[model samples]
Target: MRQTRRIAETPPPEECDPRVEALVNDLIGRVADKWTMIVLEVLAQRGELRFTQLFRLVRGVSQKMLTQTLRHMERDGMVTRTVHPVVPPRVEYRLTDLGASLGAAFCGVWIWAEDNLTRVEDARARFDDRQT
Candidate 1:
């Protein structure tokens, strides 16, 4: 028998539990959304934010969509929602340790994008020219 030593290799399906595999798919779908990534970035950078503040910071996201995304994040244990006993029932959101770790993991992807931006743009331009 032979074994792979590749550092970036994904686990063999036979080695993965079906429930965990399904959860991975679900998680990717959730985190792959534009709003979720933007929200994560904002929360990671800005520390804690009020609902209105996040709405303002994450431009182009409607209040309803943002609310849904935040609720999902909260359910995933990525963000903590705090409600203050105040005049208008103020609510605040901050990243949990898990979310911060996720942000840290994605920092590598950002760096990769920065390094490869030119190559990607050139590839797109070439592809577009071919399509015309």
Candidate 2:
């Protein structure tokens, strides 16, 4: 019988294709943006939300920035936007399965950051002390 490999088990750096590496790096840069991560977290936790609700949930985001972030996420297949055919034309945004998976993947990073917060701060302090 043949064994199957999982998507999480990536090839070693030396064995990775340069194009694939470039694409992955590009995707990470885009998806790891503060606004993108915040939006993803909000949607993941809240399930689905209207524009006004999202705007209120994601504090510090401007209307233009929120719209652009939603458009980008939709383009990347991470989110779905739906419009209701009502008098006010209600619109809602929700995370797609892919988006939820991405959020799950990021959970490890968030955990690491929280766990190492004090260590990181101490390191920064040591570096500053050394410079002074």
RMSD of each: 3.5, 3.8
> What is the per-residue lDDT of model 1 for residues 64-107, given as tens digits with 9 covering 90 to 100?
99999999999999999999999989999999999888778778
Clashes of each: 0, 0
Off by over 4 Å in 2: 1-19
lDDT of each: 0.92, 0.92
Per-residue alpha-carbon lDDT of model 2 for 4-66, expressed as tens digits? 546689555577789888977876997778999999999999999999999999999999999
Write out the backbone clash pairs for model 2: none
Candidate 2, position 107, lDDT: 90
lDDT: which candidate is best?
Answer: 2
For candidate 2, what is the lDDT? 0.92
RMSD of 2: 3.8
| Candidate 1: clashing pairs of residues | none
